[model samples]
Target: MSSPRRVTLSPTSSAASSAGFGAGSFVVGSLGGGSSFSIRSTLSARACLDCFSPSVSAMGAPPAPRQHQSEPATRQSVQSPPIATTAVFSALVERAQTQYAKSGDRYIGYRVLGDGPIDLLALNNGSNIWIDRDDEPHWAHFDRRLSSFTRLIRFDPSGVGLSDPLGAGELPTVELWTQDALAVLNAVESEHAALLGVSDGGPVAMLLSAMYPERISALVLMNSSARIARDDDYPCGIPQHLLDRFVNTVSDPTGGEDRVDDLALLAPSLAGDPEFQLWWKTAGERSAGPTTAKALDTLATAFDVRGILPLIRVPTLVMYRLDHPFLRPGHAHYLAEHVAGAKLVELPGRDHLAYVGETEPLLDEIEEFLTGTRGGSDTERVLATILFTDIVDSTKRASTAGDRLWREQLDNHDRMAARQLQRFGGRQVKSTGDGLLATFDGPARAIQCGLAMCDGARQLGMDVRVGIHTGEVERRGTDIAGIGVHIASRVQACAEPGEVWVSRTLTDLLAGSAVTFADRGDHTLKGVPGTWQLFKVEG
Candidate 1:
């Protein structure tokens, strides 16, 4: 007898928690008799319901689904550990779009997202362009939430992801890192912006704020210290010998298992997750080589920004996790005491990473501190542009091609769809037999994605019809529902094979945009109230 088919669904957000897989990584549902396909999320975490219905497995076996863990729901963000297939994980990384900034002979990589009033620049440790990919669902949500209130700017320093690497044995000083931040700010033409310094990035922020007081509006530090190494004055800092050992372990490429074990200490919340351990090792290796990582660590050990604390003239807020082993409570208190009029809020958690362990509380404090008001709770409904596609003559083609060939075609189609979805920033809702259902924050992106999907299908010897509509949709846990979804599916039915169709609502929204449409005349949609105007996308 063949083994039972298994479907694994992991939650990427609080919204996706209901379908189980709360702490799991990417979404992969591979069945036996039918076909297997991967799932994708949006720029932010929208509800992702596992939409696969396994009657028979794609591997020609019987269908059976199993959950990875029955643990209570833990809000898993991109900051959570990854428990996904390599293909799915790589697809997540492909979503990142890094822009370059010139800093003398070196080029710094940066990304600018959102258009909030205040420009908030993020100074993260070796995770500038890499972290922005939303590899973890909640990480994406965290960024989106920040963008909702502030114009968020994130960049990688020298010797980090997408940035110019340092020469052999060349270590970066805090001043050099400060210049890297300045170059990013100038690249975006940001005259003044708030700075968000996380972990080691705190010292850089403090240094920048102190030197360029006129250019910085405010400062916020999280799970970071003014001085990482212990001295006579600050006895609470990590001991030099212990710091050296920690740095060695983290920078040793061969000691991946040690890093994996230590990652649990860094993020105890994800300690038991096997997938997270795999992702941590993979991420470390990809972000930087062992030599560069060691050099960066050695530089961090010398980071002492306490002298500059009093020089910082901008409003400052210092926050730290109370129980973090490496970054003890004393560091936060010292920062608050030294930085003039700085407010210190002690957070309750052992997880050293800022995004893990009760992120909302940290976000709440940040929002209030920066925006002067705490925003409302996560919304259950949002405005979205829904896209629906259908494969023309799929059933007949499947029968003629046989199951093996048909499954291969389906897998190829799945990958093609994932690429397009990532390209256009569309979130995959679910698979509808031969086609797909997805949503985008903007109608133009949705339209472009639909066209791209249709073109890609043609290359695979298939014809796909697409329909798009923009309206408010109710978030029903991992699944989305409401009239908007129904209308989009219905609009897709109006399209001829290989044609892209859209409701008048979507076309109206896209007015003055680059996308052009031809009038298909007004027609009565099935199971709908009034007459609807539809349009076919012009090539």
Candidate 2:
């Protein structure tokens, strides 16, 4: 196979500067036969992929073949939060005003968030991006982690999501889909972005990187394949019989229950959870109708990007679960082998979805490859008391006070909270919009801070809830992140107006202190692991 051409830009180059390509960042504009280029500052691709294995579990048994079984009647009616309850979901719903990117007469829907140094375009796995809002817990894991480090842009291609739906009997082709991605990039004023493709979106990312070398800086393919059908050479493809069976199943849209079969294959980890199953079913129905789903399935069966793999010139990372039921490890191996300089990282999980299981490992790999640093708690962690406080019914309060008045009241609330933090020897980490997050060296100090803040807010005629937890937290630059932080936030959510809730850890640490507590009993914190013993603090 011929090599791709390379074009380098000096720091003073107008083209490079205008494109927002940084000084040390490598840019592969085009490739010529047998050409090679060097990246001066970036870590070697091999090093990034091989460095992290301690956190990853050993490979387990391969996943079972997905069975077409009807979900139990009891499981079908499971209850979940309204999609708008999640902040990100609510934001996406309110700001559904997507920018249009013209591809032919049809326009693709796109949204941009964050202003981090790197431009990251997240490609959907043939699902409407909005459907992700249905399961905020699952999707937030990716949105928060990725948006924290990169200028993230998410879009729905033609025939999916909020973008223009396909015409009757019309199916989307690779070329058309690729054009949709390009149009979104143009609309977002991004010269180049690292494409992060999940599941079926991988082939599209591969095609875009090969065809539009200049517009793509790097490629991240997660649990995706070049083709779906098994042939003599590609034994990993789904057997012809299985493909036909799956197609027929999806082609016939019965009820949301029927989608469980597909969900079982796509995300087995979530299939058993009644709440997740319901959300998945609703999301499937909302993302595309039966006809569109069938068309997408048909298009997926015809995908063959083996020829395009070798043509890709930029840095590439291929991540796949060792036990993915549909897309096998063989397919991942084929991609890594064919794509020049591609790094293949086999993660331990049966779930095909990227957001499932330990997502931090995947995020760590991506951050390291793109920015030469693995972000998250991997940096530094310390045991500290975390405090989370929030004003109750702040939205209603804001509306009642109007914008100017609300701003002044919020300012007063913040100042009072800061003063309490200072008096209680707590460090104000950051404001939580309507409240604040503070840290303290001791649980006594944290409890005192929360009590003072609550009393002060009550005096201001604003009710607030405070939650405190003592645990190890990872320091991420100016902010802190970890399961501990999540636990504290969840604890705060459990508190009623004017109440101070804390974890058992906090109560235990404050044994000698004057702080007293009434047991709140063991409660399940949403999106957090395990039942936590909480307490209501009393002076």
Please give the lDDT score at residue 446 for candidate 2: 78
Q: For model 1, what is the alpha-carbon lDDT of residue 362?
A: 69
Name the 10 consecutive residues with the lowest summed lDDT in model 1.
29-38
Q: What TM-score does prediction 2 earn?
A: 0.53
Question: In candidate 1, which residue ranges exceed 4 Å CA deviation?
Answer: 1-96, 131-133, 256-260, 373-539
Report lDDT (Cα) of residue 83, candidate 2. 24
lDDT of each: 0.62, 0.62
**Number of clashing pairs, model 2?**
5
> What's the lDDT for residue 474 in model 2?
72
Clashes of each: 14, 5
Q: Which candidate wins on TM-score? A: 2
